[model samples]
Target chain A: MTTPALEAKGISKRWPRTGAVLADCSLRVERRTVHALIGASGSGKSTLLRCLGLLEPPDAGSILVDGALAVDQGVVAADRSVRRSVGMVFQEPSLFAHLSALANVSLAPHRVLGLDPESARNRACSALDRVHALHLADRRPDELSGGERQRVAIARALAMEPSVLLCDEPTSALDPLLTREVMAVLRELALDAGTTMVVVTHDLDFVAAAADSVDFLHAGRIRISGTADLLGTRGLDDELDRFLQRS
Target chain B: MPRVLAPLLVLLATMAAAADDGMARLRASGIMRWGCDISGGAPFAFPDPSDPDRVIGFEVEIAEELAHRLGVRAERFSADWLALIDALEADRCDLLINGFEVTADRERVVAFSTPYFRYAQQLVVRAEDRDRFTSLADLAGRPIAVLNGSASIESLRSAGVPPSLIVEYDDSLAPFTETILGRVDACLQESFIAQFFAGHDPRLALVDAAFDPGIYAVVVRQGDDDLLASVNAALASMRADGTLGRILQRWGLWSDAQRELGIDRGPIIATIPEAIGTPPEDGLPWSLVLWSLARAAAMTALLTIVSMPIATFVGLLLAIAILHGPKPLSRFCHGYVLLTRGTPLLVQIFLLYYSLPALGAWLGIPELLTWNKVVVGIVCLAANYAAYEAEIHRAALQAIPQSQWDAARALGFTRAQTLRFIIVPQSWRLSLPAIINDLNSLIKDSSLVSMIGVQELLAVALGIGKASFAVPSMLVAAAAFYLVLSLLADWFGQSLERRARTVGTLPEPIHR
Candidate 1:
């Protein structure tokens, strides 16, 4: 099989105050595919996503991106290259309040990637256009609506053209109507641009509709993992079934 | 025609003043600036107990009588006694009339008026230690205090006392206090000062024999022959008419010095006349004061501008070091902030300008470290404020959410890059108002540097007050300059903050 775009093996994290938020969780995402991690509150879905995104250093794990070791035995390797390849969209739409959406998108390309300002700006414009957020490019974070700000944030990450994109509950703050709009754009990017994506969510319906693959996490471990089509046909295990029924 | 006439008239008046004698200018101005020291307290120039603002003393009366004779108002200009002669030479005052004793050494730099009073130096010791220090010779090996820059210091050295044994104080009271407190074995003073201080408290008494009889004279600048001659004529007339003796008698200061000079026998004045009155009606010439203030403001601007960038840069480094540097460096930065912010700016300036030179001397590199007062002021102000600025920068940096750092790091930016491009710019925006406030305060605090003799705006105005005895006007003018500069700084800071928030920012203006 072609090499997976991103892989995390036996990820475990223990917080100083709260022990064992994530434990021995492993995930594999194929190129151009949309994968979803779904769990109840207090589960380690977000923690696993963060570890895969390299936002948090796992207590124990090896992460590989594009068949190259990004983290080996819980020690980060090729950190800068790993971070450059993996992009993150925070749940709260972490846009720099001082910068316009376009500058926010262009900043990393111009400054971090050493692209010329014109080229960076052009790339920023295209990224925004790709996310259907072109109209909001010039707006500051405060000036944009909740959904528009989230889209701009996504565009900022896309501008970097990462090999894998990780988002944590990006649509959690949005109403159902805006959630649908954002998910539609995200689906288009995954299908048309062949952009690999990992999303952490609490919504089973969202996973059922948009996710190509699904992993059910509970109490810091993955209980079941499969193609979404298979899960939908064969149904969930007892624990996941109870979780789905309750939520 | 009117404008031409006005310029021509002003030119004529300026030339006339330049051509005339110093005495003529003094008479024309109708205000004689009398320089003296008031920190020494009573019997020379001390605050009048009845009206705290007005100073009263024998010298004050003498000046008033002299000004009355010269047909002008007598205005008191007080500085330290050590600075009195310098004040006279700088034209900050017309004359130094404060118990200034004429000696061969002093006569080289200044011309003294004819003798108005003559007094011998009296050695005073604590009552308990009086017998042990019976005379100057007996106190030879002991630590004896004398007024700094006084003739007493010179006389004590000549009287076979070791130079190191003679501690000099700028204020007159410190020597006597030190003696009574047993910190010093003896203190030398003019006979009259020794009498006044020792007479009040039984704990103190005079050593038996007086020494170094010297004549008190009003000192004028060396080339001020015309004013000197006029002052002599005034003194001679006061002597002939017994005005000097009567004034002295009222202050209970009539002594054999007057009898020896043949001016002691005069009508006894029963009551001490009220020498000081309400402040003079003539307000300071605002236009002239403003002109002088504007010139001084240039130095103030130089101090502020030159120091600010240095302070900010140092503060930035310190803040970063505290936050991210190695452990030792972070601790050092923390210590720096603690020490600088914990102390007074006045003490810091004194350390930088005064103690630093002493330190340099100890280090055998005094020449390199001995900077001019202005340079020292800048260095000190910058260093002192940098501690504050570092705190400001640290606060601003901390105020930025941790997510911002995460965002920058996740974007493949190095840590320094994240700080330099992303964090610092945003922190600066939040810190601008506080920084501007500090800068404004610094401009005002620049006045404290005057203690080390940097004649910045306020110092220059004060110098003018010394020369013309126009304190109110000079202060008002200096305050106005500071106010204007602060307002300008505020405006500039606001503009920068606005630019930081809006400039080159996107969300290109929208078309429907």
Candidate 2:
């Protein structure tokens, strides 16, 4: 009842080339929780996440962040503070090739938030230390391995101190071992910092291991919502049953 | 050095004579071949602008009359103005009869006829300051422009004008033009050239007194006395019969000095048109020559250094405009890239230095009226290369993956900050090699500005070469300067590409 931290009402998006990617989908996330959206490749999970992150606007919907109208009727809020409250990480760790990881993490705070360089750098160091990537601060993106780069990217987002973090397949580019390393960092952020995150991931086992709640998205809508107990309880929905078995 | 060069002249003359047919073979051929450059200017040998195919001048009439008297038809042969002597030596023509000045060194190299016409130098000033700058002495602190290698320079120096205050033009009309524009205080040139080029221009006026009198004569190959004798007899008869006077009057070149050309003479004191300070043909010290070349090279370098930063900055703006500016500006930038990159740099420079002033005058912009040739050169070089730089930058910007843009924007960065922080730094790396390539090319392209009288490396070196007939050495020295500058640019460029490279950027592990 504390405004659910972030909420979307009836989000719909239709692309000209591929029509009806997301249709009238609604989602709600609470503070201090990790929520996972799991779907097949073509199921519009990333599109929904993009809309929630305000990376792109939905055709019809209103998004509320911290009880404020961040987006309404497909028109995104023009205020930087609205966008600043939500941070995003891409599937591939597209770090700035020319900057050290430390500079990369500090750039948004210094430039967009109008913080001075010294303060931004201090924030960056703390964020990197929180993600256990302090040793990789001086390295360029190319110098870091898959796991370290993902951790640095997470640090970059955390340095901005967003209210809600949206990640699309954050571990899709990593092997199983590196995926576990990145997963541990995300678990630590949720446990120690109480940071809220909405993640769209193909890795269902990661959801079972770490996600506090799960939304089963299919055919452009969230068809079912449950906890980990629902994944083991079969025969509730055949589509979701087949999806869990395939995983 | 003249002591050594005099016999060397004789040796070259001997080789020339061995290739010649002599006067007897010329009479059998029944055509009197005459060489002249038809492009210098009027009242001399030049193409009639109204009918360019008809080459007409006082010298053309003389060639006709002299050929008629020798019972042969006159046929025109083409040669460069400075290379007429070599042309005659190589048998490209039978006689050299342009506005050929009778110089002392030339007198050693070939034979000169009696003075058929005496020409003197006229000092021109802006009409408003006609009285203030009457003589070379009056131009002590003020800049004076003249045709490079003209005898006017000798007389000006004799009258105690410093060489630093003298500006030499590569062509004839720029002198009067510069004077009228107030870029120079005055210009000095032969009376005929001043009259032909500036007679109708109300902005310019010639001084009442003509000084530094020199003569025009016909030059023949050495040891060809039969041909020389025929030429001399024909000129003497033309002078006596008043035909030479009529030709001069027609060209508006006749003056009282012609009466002293003397009656029916073989030689009237083999004239000395040489200035006292003429660089001795073989006596130039290497250090002096190299020092002058270095100064000129510095100008070239300054032009490159000043213009390149402007080009790169403008190029970045243009690239951004094309890539991310609003629709109309993007279209405009696209057109700009096409228009600038499609044109030649020389033609672009010519338009900026030459045509722009005319346009400026029409638009009533006073500043354009006096654009220093160097300033125009800098602007033109920057603009011309900015097009290329824009393309380099655009490609580099595009080469950055779309994910980079999304990542920055997701961090709440506006478009400009994304470009400044993430995009441009990486684009610079991709553009470095190409930008350095353009920087080195800009150094050489700076020479085209000399076409408008910049007095840069090639211009200054060419002026001295054109005078001393030592073009090869001067060119080699200039080339060495350019080569050294290019190497410095290369080292600077390579070092820039190496820096800001966080890792072991100098070298890395060799692939097995």
Q: Mind listing the fnat for each candidate?
A: 0.44, 0.52
What TM-score does prediction 2 earn?
0.66
Ten-residue stretch with the least lDDT total in model 2 chain A = A202-211
Off by over 4 Å in 1: A230-236, B1-285, B361-364, B505-512
Residue-level lDDT tens digits of model 1 in B1-512? 11222233223223322233669879889999888866555577765433333567888889999999988899887654555564454345688898888888778767889888888899888888767778777775789888776789888878778788989875566687788778888899888777766655678888887888888889987767788898999888998888899888877778776777657548866646332222224544556556656867878988999998788889988999999889999999999999999988876765455444444545556567667768988999999999999999999989989988877777788888878877887888888889989999888888877665555787666555432334456678778889899999999898878787883532222121
Best by lDDT: 2
**Residue B64 Cα positional deviation in candidate 2, in Å, after optimal superposition:** 33
- What TM-score would every model get versus the actual structure? 0.67, 0.66
CAPRI level of candidate 1: acceptable
Best by TM-score: 1
lDDT of 1 by residue, A131-207 (tens): 99998877778889888988998998999999999988988889988887777778788678888899887666667
lDDT of each: 0.77, 0.78
Assign candidate 2 its CAPRI class: incorrect
Candidate 2, residues B1-512: lDDT per residue as tens digits? 11332343345445435343557867889999898755344556653332333567778899999999988999986533544565465454689788777877678778898778888989888989878877767767988898876688887887888899889985576787689778998998888788766665677888888888998899887778888888899888999877887777666666678888852322323212221113354555566667667888999999999999999999999999999999999999999999999988866765554344444434556344537768888999999889999999999999999999888988999998888878888888899999999999999999877755466887666555533434567788889999999999999999898884543232211110
